[model samples]
Target: MTKPLDLKHVALSDLHISLLNMRHKPKTTKGRSNEPILDDILPSIRERGIRQPLLVRPEPTKDNKNAYGIIAGRRRYFCLQAIVSEGGEVGGVPVCIMNADDDAQAIEASIIENMARLAPTPMEQHTAFDKLSKKGKTIAEIASVFGITTRMVKQRLALGQLIPVLKQAYTDSEIDNETIFALTMATKKQQKDWFDLFSTDEYTPTGEQLKAWLSGGGCITVEKALFPMEDYKGTILTDLFGEHDQFADIEKFWSAQNAAISVQADEYKKDGWRDVFVGDIGRHFPRYDYAQRTKEQGGNVYVQIGDNGDVHFHEGFMPKEEAKRIDAILHKKPDADSNASNRPEMSGPLLEYMSLHRHSIARAHLLKHPKIALRLTVAHMLTSSGNWKVERDYQRTSKESTDLSLTNSRAEQELATERQAICELLEYRCEHFQLYQRYSSPFNIEDVFGRLINMDDNSVMRIMTFCMCETLKNESGAVEAVAVLTGAKFEEYWVPDDGFFDLLRDKSVLNLMVKDIAGKSTAEYALTDTAKSQKQIILNRIAGQGVENPSPNWRPKWASFPSQSYRGKGSVF
Candidate 1:
């Protein structure tokens, strides 16, 4: 037997969309279909004075007390929101509050209620199933909940693997089911290339043609082989539609080709070449970037492998810089005035010893005068003189979603705003300036100096601080030191999103996060659960869903200023 949900009336202002809602999409996801139409529902609700009650749970975080997160009836909530926006007088809307602790139950109720009202789109279904899957629900269990076949559930899950653009394209009805399904087989690079072609007026393959394109234009024919055909140990694939025979195994073909390349490299080495460098497959060797050089002048052999299995060797070539250096040495115009040898009196070790001691004395003296040190630091950033070649940190990440997450983060946005303000203050025309752009236009030194001279001391300090922040190296000891000194709070600037959760794979770390948010007892109970289950528990607690007391503004240890590992084994700081 189950207890009934408590029925109540909640004000529209107190309700918000929940993270658990199946229809809830992150703002980061662009080109998504518009929200459900409220026109039809608004008219009916306005006339009849409301009908069905919205299903909601207690707001997940303590920051919003007395508020509720709508798990079901999102469209109705939106309709009510619209009505209020239009300055319509509305009373407390009817609501049914579910147990906030039971995330799985809340999710199930949301899905069931949505299904009862209207069929969700395939992408929406995928989003729901993906959440369920992350909550430790098996494929069979999810299928059972939705009353669909396991195969259908799996098909929905596969949609999660598609890139955001492809997903958006499918949602926009620009591409059909067959085209999308075929694209699933394509690699990220291939999908990106295909999408680039599709976005233009170029001929983009579709459906069966896409499948053929993914198969490297219907297999690697023997005539396309860079190595001897007899050297390949794999069976040859014969195409009935074409006259030429193809290689059955792409891997095997590459192996023979690579072996042949190695042999050629060795031959070059034996033929008095300085060095033989083999670039990775798909890498292009730019001949125009290099200068032809004789073997005696430290020329090297460069082997480039094309994507289509073609190989080309660039012989007797060196970098333009190296060529110039060699030319300078060979075409020397000696100074006839004196015969003094171009040699230093001090040995290398002696010079290094003296330099280190001198540097130590200067550093010790500089450490005593904090104000002087600050001025020197500012000077280094402003002029970029001596060894101070200040450059912005790249903040590189392999995952596209993670990269996007950082780009769209509140912290990044705040920095951009600050940069724009600074640019305006400096009297620069930077209407379209991006703070992190690789090749931003250079500021005129005279114009900048003239402006800075007129600014107040505090204003100059702010500019200096921003410049230091921009050039600060990421993942360095300086970052940890500064974080500790400043008491930097990451939670104020960052929140967990799909990108953060997707990158988490360690079970131990996930369990630790569970303990941090849900408590030791809950963590112990879920110790043997799947990584996905632990992750959901963490998210639920963060949202203030199922816990008695939720940690507001909760952040993982790794996201902390001086990041720490769960086991204290791999402290990145």
Candidate 2:
């Protein structure tokens, strides 16, 4: 008592505690928000000294004006306060008087300290991000600060809001990233749909089944899965125990009859996939008695034998001899009513895309710049843009689009830049494409020639999009889309349309009908027979210019069209 207590080495419980003159921290529980581990701290403090230090501020009350306040370690201070109630010898704990003079300093210090030492779990990270997300932080800002991709950040953040059971299971490694991402795409009800499967001993579902279920995309709850087994098509398949079921009551009837029955058809033999699912599932499989002849294969039919490879069935074809006899026009088309194989993806949307493109092509035909018509179509290599692996958005799948890893930092930047380029290119091309169609249409340009070219990637894409969609409408005083194409000023300078029609209008090699949208004239240009003879050479020059041309796609195909046609068809549309 006489000598001053050395603050260096003392139990935290031996210290007095008080709240500082600071704002309430009710919001502190958000995102890695530190809380007094009241549960652990109090109990642990009763047994030993606090292992960590807590930051404190000077109290501002009149009575304790000079006394220190607790800025942090409130949880630690609380444990000591509890100990002092238990008649603990609370005195002389070491304290570090922070130099923070204001509340802002205190918060900044706290954040800095936490950032320095606290490496939160993914869950914790997501929680922190969630708080910021609510404040309207964009993905770019999040990515820049975290040095991670927005996609990754969004995924983790989404994981935090999942059901407690799913979240816990995920944290414990019961599930996987793909499953979680797939689940994220589902609604709460849809998520509930699979809850029952997760409840019992058979919680684990095959990857394919899970994917199929999730792809249905709707509200799914637990109650739905129990009564009716949702078939592959998300339809109810009841009387599940009946004859038409995938399962059979062979055990009830067969008793102990271990029947060895093997059935085959010529179709499975012809598909050359004889070793595929059927070979193993059909051969050496027990007759569960559930057999349904669903469809025809190559020249015959197929049947399920028993449960094999995560599935069971008793497969064998009836009317097998007749179906297999005629190999003349056999096709592997299952009966319409059959529910065996899943439906191939619907192509209606694809048809819609074709419809749109077909409309565009028609518009292109009526365009002032005419194009060539090949006798055949070239096969296209389609890749999904999901991974950004390819340039085409139509070519990629979701998974593949996500998988497009940039080659490096520079490549990532380039990809982003290039994507922007494509967007802008669409702008110009769409407008230009539409402008031409409106000015030139329903006319054949078998004899016409021209090529539009561009060096700027972004400008090129704008041109392409213009071609794909329609040309843009500039402000009345704004530059004409055609002017950009022709490299001309529109102030009454002799900047004729300078496009396909303008170049081929009075030319001898080609013929085209063009109405000057600028109120100039409607004229037709036809290529002479001599020019047609040299069409190959002329076409090559235009093609070369298109490939390595000085001008942009804006130039009318006629303007870009190379003369001296000794080779082939020139740029028509």
Model 2 per-residue lDDT tens digits across residues 1-573: 223222344445333333221222444332544334455347656787676666655555555445665544555576777788789766555555565355444443343333322323455455556655665667666655544567667666776556766766665567765565555544577667676677678764434355445534222222322122332223321121111212122222122111212222333445442222333433653222212133343222333333321223222333335434543346565567676567655488987887899889876775643222210000000111122121222323354323332222343454445445543532322211222322222111221111222133344334344332222232322234444565643222212221322234343333221111111121221122223322322332232321234221122233322221212474232
Provide the clashing-pair count of each candidate structure: 3, 94
Q: Could you tell me the TM-score of candidate 1?
A: 0.40
Query: Which residue ranges in model 1 land beyond 4 Å of their true spot?
Result: 1-388, 434-441, 544-552, 569-571
* 441: Cα error in model 2, Å: 55
Worst 10 residues of 1 by lDDT: 435-444
Angstrom error at residue 435, model 2 = 51
Residue 361 lDDT in candidate 2: 88
